[model samples]
Target: MPDESATLALGAALWPQLPVTGCVYLSGDLGAGKTTLVRGLLRAAGHDGAVRSPTYTLIEPYELVGRQVFHLDLYRLGDPEELEFIGLRELLGQGLLLVEWPAQGRGVLPAPDWTIDLAADGQGRQATLAIQ
Candidate 1:
Protein backbone atom coordinates (compact mmCIF):
# COMPACT_ATOMS: atom_id res chain seq x y z
CA MET A 1 0.00 0.00 0.00
CA PRO A 2 1.16 3.48 -0.78
CA ASP A 3 0.77 6.74 1.13
CA GLU A 4 -2.16 9.10 0.41
CA SER A 5 -0.35 11.71 -1.70
CA ALA A 6 1.73 9.11 -3.46
CA THR A 7 -1.28 7.00 -4.23
CA LEU A 8 -3.17 9.99 -5.55
CA ALA A 9 -0.21 11.07 -7.64
CA LEU A 10 0.32 7.58 -8.94
CA GLY A 11 -3.31 7.41 -9.93
CA ALA A 12 -3.06 10.76 -11.67
CA ALA A 13 0.08 9.76 -13.51
CA LEU A 14 -1.55 6.55 -14.60
CA TRP A 15 -4.64 8.30 -15.88
CA PRO A 16 -3.23 8.95 -19.32
CA GLN A 17 -2.10 5.37 -19.65
CA LEU A 18 -5.46 3.90 -18.75
CA PRO A 19 -7.74 2.31 -21.34
CA VAL A 20 -9.46 5.63 -21.97
CA THR A 21 -12.86 3.99 -21.68
CA GLY A 22 -13.30 2.46 -18.24
CA CYS A 23 -14.13 3.28 -14.66
CA VAL A 24 -12.11 3.21 -11.47
CA TYR A 25 -13.92 2.10 -8.31
CA LEU A 26 -12.77 3.32 -4.93
CA SER A 27 -13.75 0.95 -2.14
CA GLY A 28 -13.10 2.12 1.39
CA ASP A 29 -14.57 3.45 4.60
CA LEU A 30 -15.71 6.98 5.27
CA GLY A 31 -13.03 9.70 5.59
CA ALA A 32 -10.76 7.54 3.48
CA GLY A 33 -9.60 10.41 1.27
CA LYS A 34 -11.29 9.06 -1.84
CA THR A 35 -12.40 12.53 -2.77
CA THR A 36 -8.99 13.88 -1.88
CA LEU A 37 -7.42 11.44 -4.29
CA VAL A 38 -9.87 12.58 -6.93
CA ARG A 39 -9.03 16.17 -6.24
CA GLY A 40 -5.43 15.38 -6.86
CA LEU A 41 -6.35 13.64 -10.08
CA LEU A 42 -8.38 16.59 -11.31
CA ARG A 43 -5.63 19.01 -10.40
CA ALA A 44 -3.16 16.87 -12.25
CA ALA A 45 -5.48 16.93 -15.20
CA GLY A 46 -5.35 20.74 -15.14
CA HIS A 47 -8.53 21.56 -13.27
CA ASP A 48 -8.69 24.30 -10.67
CA GLY A 49 -12.28 24.09 -9.43
CA ALA A 50 -13.31 23.09 -5.94
CA VAL A 51 -13.47 19.34 -5.72
CA ARG A 52 -16.31 18.14 -3.54
CA SER A 53 -17.91 14.82 -2.88
CA PRO A 54 -21.05 14.05 -4.81
CA THR A 55 -22.76 12.56 -1.77
CA TYR A 56 -26.05 14.39 -2.12
CA THR A 57 -26.12 14.64 -5.88
CA LEU A 58 -24.70 11.16 -6.54
CA ILE A 59 -22.36 12.42 -9.28
CA GLU A 60 -20.30 15.42 -10.33
CA PRO A 61 -18.91 16.04 -13.78
CA TYR A 62 -15.84 18.01 -14.66
CA GLU A 63 -14.36 19.03 -17.97
CA LEU A 64 -10.61 19.00 -17.54
CA VAL A 65 -7.95 19.40 -20.19
CA GLY A 66 -10.47 18.49 -22.86
CA ARG A 67 -11.47 15.30 -21.14
CA GLN A 68 -14.58 14.60 -19.13
CA VAL A 69 -14.08 13.40 -15.57
CA PHE A 70 -16.89 12.05 -13.46
CA HIS A 71 -16.71 11.67 -9.72
CA LEU A 72 -19.43 9.62 -8.10
CA ASP A 73 -20.36 9.03 -4.49
CA LEU A 74 -22.77 6.18 -4.03
CA TYR A 75 -23.13 6.41 -0.26
CA ARG A 76 -26.68 7.71 -0.41
CA LEU A 77 -27.95 5.30 -2.99
CA GLY A 78 -30.61 2.99 -1.58
CA ASP A 79 -30.61 0.61 -4.55
CA PRO A 80 -29.13 -0.11 -7.96
CA GLU A 81 -32.44 0.77 -9.54
CA GLU A 82 -31.68 4.42 -9.10
CA LEU A 83 -28.81 4.26 -11.59
CA GLU A 84 -31.03 4.26 -14.63
CA PHE A 85 -32.86 7.32 -13.38
CA ILE A 86 -29.59 9.22 -13.22
CA GLY A 87 -28.55 8.40 -16.80
CA LEU A 88 -25.50 6.50 -15.63
CA ARG A 89 -25.13 4.56 -18.85
CA GLU A 90 -24.80 7.66 -20.93
CA LEU A 91 -22.27 9.43 -18.77
CA LEU A 92 -20.09 6.37 -18.21
CA GLY A 93 -18.87 5.67 -21.72
CA GLN A 94 -17.34 9.07 -22.26
CA GLY A 95 -15.39 10.01 -19.15
CA LEU A 96 -12.94 8.95 -16.52
CA LEU A 97 -15.04 7.78 -13.57
CA LEU A 98 -13.85 7.87 -9.99
CA VAL A 99 -16.39 6.27 -7.73
CA GLU A 100 -16.62 6.18 -3.94
CA TRP A 101 -18.56 3.61 -1.89
CA PRO A 102 -18.92 1.48 -4.98
CA ALA A 103 -20.28 -1.46 -3.03
CA GLN A 104 -23.48 0.47 -2.66
CA GLY A 105 -24.17 0.13 -6.39
CA ARG A 106 -22.99 -3.47 -6.79
CA GLY A 107 -24.51 -5.19 -9.80
CA VAL A 108 -25.87 -2.08 -11.37
CA LEU A 109 -22.43 -0.65 -11.95
CA PRO A 110 -19.95 -1.80 -14.51
CA ALA A 111 -16.91 -3.90 -13.72
CA PRO A 112 -14.11 -1.53 -12.82
CA ASP A 113 -10.90 -1.41 -14.80
CA TRP A 114 -9.10 -0.46 -11.62
CA THR A 115 -9.81 -0.54 -7.90
CA ILE A 116 -8.41 1.66 -5.13
CA ASP A 117 -8.89 0.73 -1.50
CA LEU A 118 -7.88 3.13 1.26
CA ALA A 119 -7.68 2.37 4.98
CA ALA A 120 -6.63 4.48 7.92
CA ASP A 121 -3.37 3.61 9.58
CA GLY A 122 -2.70 5.81 12.58
CA GLN A 123 -2.51 9.40 11.35
CA GLY A 124 -1.94 8.41 7.72
CA ARG A 125 -3.40 5.78 5.36
CA GLN A 126 -2.67 2.60 3.47
CA ALA A 127 -3.82 2.63 -0.13
CA THR A 128 -3.95 -0.52 -2.22
CA LEU A 129 -4.43 -0.13 -5.93
CA ALA A 130 -5.27 -3.00 -8.25
CA ILE A 131 -5.41 -2.84 -11.99
CA GLN A 132 -7.39 -5.47 -13.80
Candidate 2:
Protein backbone atom coordinates (compact mmCIF):
# COMPACT_ATOMS: atom_id res chain seq x y z
CA MET A 1 0.00 0.00 0.00
CA PRO A 2 1.33 3.42 -0.89
CA ASP A 3 -1.07 5.56 1.04
CA GLU A 4 -3.91 5.59 3.51
CA SER A 5 -6.46 5.12 0.78
CA ALA A 6 -4.67 2.04 -0.46
CA THR A 7 -4.57 0.70 3.07
CA LEU A 8 -8.28 1.28 3.41
CA ALA A 9 -8.96 -0.48 0.15
CA LEU A 10 -6.88 -3.43 1.24
CA GLY A 11 -8.90 -3.71 4.41
CA ALA A 12 -12.17 -3.53 2.53
CA ALA A 13 -10.98 -6.19 0.16
CA LEU A 14 -10.07 -8.43 3.06
CA TRP A 15 -13.50 -8.30 4.71
CA PRO A 16 -15.13 -10.88 2.48
CA GLN A 17 -12.34 -13.32 3.16
CA LEU A 18 -12.67 -13.04 6.91
CA PRO A 19 -14.62 -15.51 8.98
CA VAL A 20 -17.70 -14.27 10.77
CA THR A 21 -16.07 -14.99 14.10
CA GLY A 22 -12.32 -14.97 14.48
CA CYS A 23 -9.37 -12.90 15.61
CA VAL A 24 -7.10 -10.76 13.45
CA TYR A 25 -3.85 -9.53 14.89
CA LEU A 26 -2.54 -6.29 13.48
CA SER A 27 1.17 -5.75 13.99
CA GLY A 28 2.48 -2.30 13.22
CA ASP A 29 4.29 0.58 14.71
CA LEU A 30 2.48 3.65 15.98
CA GLY A 31 1.07 5.70 13.10
CA ALA A 32 1.48 2.75 10.78
CA GLY A 33 -2.15 2.84 9.58
CA LYS A 34 -3.45 -0.01 11.72
CA THR A 35 -6.50 1.98 12.79
CA THR A 36 -7.01 3.26 9.27
CA LEU A 37 -7.19 -0.28 7.94
CA VAL A 38 -9.63 -1.20 10.68
CA ARG A 39 -11.78 1.80 9.81
CA GLY A 40 -12.01 0.59 6.27
CA LEU A 41 -12.95 -2.92 7.34
CA LEU A 42 -15.67 -1.57 9.57
CA ARG A 43 -17.04 0.59 6.78
CA ALA A 44 -17.08 -2.32 4.40
CA ALA A 45 -18.86 -4.35 7.07
CA GLY A 46 -21.55 -1.62 7.12
CA HIS A 47 -20.51 0.41 10.13
CA ASP A 48 -21.13 4.14 9.69
CA GLY A 49 -20.19 5.50 13.07
CA ALA A 50 -16.91 6.88 14.31
CA VAL A 51 -14.07 4.39 14.28
CA ARG A 52 -11.10 5.10 16.44
CA SER A 53 -8.35 3.09 18.08
CA PRO A 54 -9.30 2.04 21.59
CA THR A 55 -5.95 3.17 22.90
CA TYR A 56 -7.08 4.27 26.32
CA THR A 57 -10.26 2.26 26.55
CA LEU A 58 -8.48 -0.91 25.45
CA ILE A 59 -11.46 -2.17 23.47
CA GLU A 60 -14.28 -0.70 21.42
CA PRO A 61 -17.30 -2.72 20.37
CA TYR A 62 -19.28 -2.30 17.20
CA GLU A 63 -22.48 -3.85 15.97
CA LEU A 64 -22.67 -4.19 12.21
CA VAL A 65 -25.64 -5.88 10.61
CA GLY A 66 -25.64 -9.37 12.15
CA ARG A 67 -22.07 -9.27 13.29
CA GLN A 68 -20.38 -7.98 16.39
CA VAL A 69 -16.90 -6.46 15.99
CA PHE A 70 -14.41 -5.65 18.67
CA HIS A 71 -11.33 -3.48 18.07
CA LEU A 72 -8.72 -3.91 20.75
CA ASP A 73 -5.60 -1.85 21.32
CA LEU A 74 -3.23 -3.41 23.79
CA TYR A 75 -0.53 -0.78 23.61
CA ARG A 76 -1.10 0.39 27.15
CA LEU A 77 -1.69 -2.93 28.75
CA GLY A 78 0.55 -3.68 31.68
CA ASP A 79 -0.36 -7.34 31.89
CA PRO A 80 -1.93 -9.89 29.59
CA GLU A 81 -4.11 -11.17 32.42
CA GLU A 82 -5.97 -7.89 32.22
CA LEU A 83 -7.67 -9.36 29.16
CA GLU A 84 -9.63 -11.74 31.38
CA PHE A 85 -11.14 -8.85 33.29
CA ILE A 86 -12.29 -7.37 30.01
CA GLY A 87 -14.14 -10.54 28.97
CA LEU A 88 -11.64 -11.54 26.28
CA ARG A 89 -12.88 -15.12 26.04
CA GLU A 90 -16.47 -14.00 25.82
CA LEU A 91 -15.69 -11.54 23.07
CA LEU A 92 -13.73 -14.16 21.14
CA GLY A 93 -16.73 -16.46 21.23
CA GLN A 94 -19.17 -13.76 20.21
CA GLY A 95 -17.55 -11.55 17.59
CA LEU A 96 -14.79 -10.67 15.21
CA LEU A 97 -11.75 -9.25 16.97
CA LEU A 98 -9.09 -6.94 15.52
CA VAL A 99 -6.19 -6.55 17.90
CA GLU A 100 -3.40 -3.98 17.74
CA TRP A 101 -0.24 -4.59 19.78
CA PRO A 102 -1.21 -8.23 19.97
CA ALA A 103 2.09 -9.14 21.54
CA GLN A 104 0.84 -7.49 24.69
CA GLY A 105 -1.89 -10.05 25.02
CA ARG A 106 0.35 -13.03 24.17
CA GLY A 107 -0.87 -15.75 26.48
CA VAL A 108 -4.31 -14.44 27.31
CA LEU A 109 -5.76 -13.79 23.89
CA PRO A 110 -6.65 -16.54 21.49
CA ALA A 111 -4.48 -17.17 18.46
CA PRO A 112 -5.46 -15.12 15.46
CA ASP A 113 -6.87 -16.61 12.30
CA TRP A 114 -5.09 -13.86 10.39
CA THR A 115 -2.18 -11.60 11.10
CA ILE A 116 -1.52 -8.34 9.28
CA ASP A 117 1.72 -6.49 9.64
CA LEU A 118 2.21 -2.91 8.52
CA ALA A 119 5.32 -0.82 8.29
CA ALA A 120 6.33 2.59 7.15
CA ASP A 121 7.72 2.56 3.66
CA GLY A 122 9.09 5.77 2.23
CA GLN A 123 6.18 8.19 2.10
CA GLY A 124 3.56 5.51 2.66
CA ARG A 125 2.96 2.18 4.33
CA GLN A 126 3.30 -1.44 3.30
CA ALA A 127 1.17 -4.28 4.60
CA THR A 128 1.58 -8.03 4.57
CA LEU A 129 -1.09 -10.54 5.54
CA ALA A 130 -0.44 -13.97 6.96
CA ILE A 131 -3.09 -16.59 7.49
CA GLN A 132 -2.73 -18.88 10.43
Find the candidate with the highest lDDT and give its number: 2
Q: What is the lDDT of residue 22 in candidate 2?
A: 92
Q: What C-alpha lDDT values do all the predictions have?
A: 0.83, 0.93
Worst lDDT run of 10 residues, candidate 1, spans 1-10
Model 2, position 47: C-alpha lDDT score: 89
Candidate 2 local lDDT, 1-132, one digit each (tens): 778899889989999899899999999999999999999999899888899999999999998899999999999999999999988888867989999999999999899999999999887898889999
Q: Cα lDDT for residue 111, model 2? A: 91
- Model 2 residue 80 distance off true place after TM-score fit, in angstroms: 0.3
Per-residue lDDT, model 2, residue 21, is: 94
Runs in model 2 deviating more than 4 A are none
